[model samples]
Target: MEFATFILAAQRGYHQSSESVIRNSIEQAVASEQAGFNTAWFAEHHFNNYSLIPSPLMMVAHCAGLTSTIRLGTAVCVLPLY
Candidate 1:
């Protein structure tokens, strides 16, 4: 069985910065790779408090350099919303 983690890249507290959330998400992806996850997924959202990740491709690019073999993916992207 293969396991994958979904990163929502959400700011958990009022004091959390968008940068911090994104950094944490990247760190989590590295950890997931170390933990033997098959893939990591990032969710995209816009003009909303739901998530801070506006582009999954951007996240994947960032994570690619940090992970060796773990696959990176996007949960879903609504192009119409973009």
Candidate 2:
């Protein structure tokens, strides 16, 4: 038997990342397929100092390019907040 799991990614804050952090996250997503994740979620935010991910869809697209099995979505994309 097996249980499905979501692989969540974050732009929790811009201060938490650098050039390598961004590229590494995508690599991590690709690796998640081997770890058995069925989906991936990205955080969406704007005007926040830490979270620089403005578009969840773009994250989804990037993840889609990296992984073959995981579906991508927004974990908490507050429209009014962005």
Candidate 3:
């Protein structure tokens, strides 16, 4: 049986991302992997303040290096559609 979990990756923006925020997000991903999560779901958004993630795919790639067990994916894929 496959259990499920989620880690919300904010749409990185002008101010949403600082060194600390990035580091913390990475840490959270690592922790989610260690905790037996099935996937780390990220979302893509355009220029806006509601969310902070523009390149959700890039986020998946980046987090892929930090964890080895869990999978990474995009949830609400808005960037490519619009």
lDDT against the true structure, per candidate, is 0.90, 0.63, 0.69
Clash pairs (backbone) in predicted model 3: 11-52, 11-53, 12-52, 12-53
Model 2, position 82: C-alpha lDDT score: 50
Clash pairs detected, candidate 1: none
Worst 10 residues of 2 by lDDT: 1-10
Ordered list by TM-score, greatest first: 1, 3, 2
Across 1-82, the per-residue lDDT of candidate 3 in tens digits comes to 7655554544356665545555666687778889888777876656654445666677789989888889888776764465
The sequence of per-residue lDDT tens digits that candidate 1 reaches over residues 1-82 is: 9999999998778698888888999999999999999999999988865799988888899899999989999897878865
Runs with alpha carbons beyond 4 Å of true place in candidate 1: none
What's the distance in Å from true for residue 48, model 2? 3.4
Q: Which stretches of candidate 2 lie over 4 Å from their true place?
A: 1-17, 80-82
The better-scoring model by lDDT among 1 and 2 is: 1
Best-to-worst lDDT order: 1, 3, 2
Return whichever of 1 and 3 wins on TM-score. 1
lDDT of 2 by residue, 30-64 (tens): 77677887766666656654455567777778778
TM-score of 1: 0.91
RMSD of each: 1.3, 3.7, 3.5
Tell me the RMSD of model 3 versus the true structure. Answer: 3.5
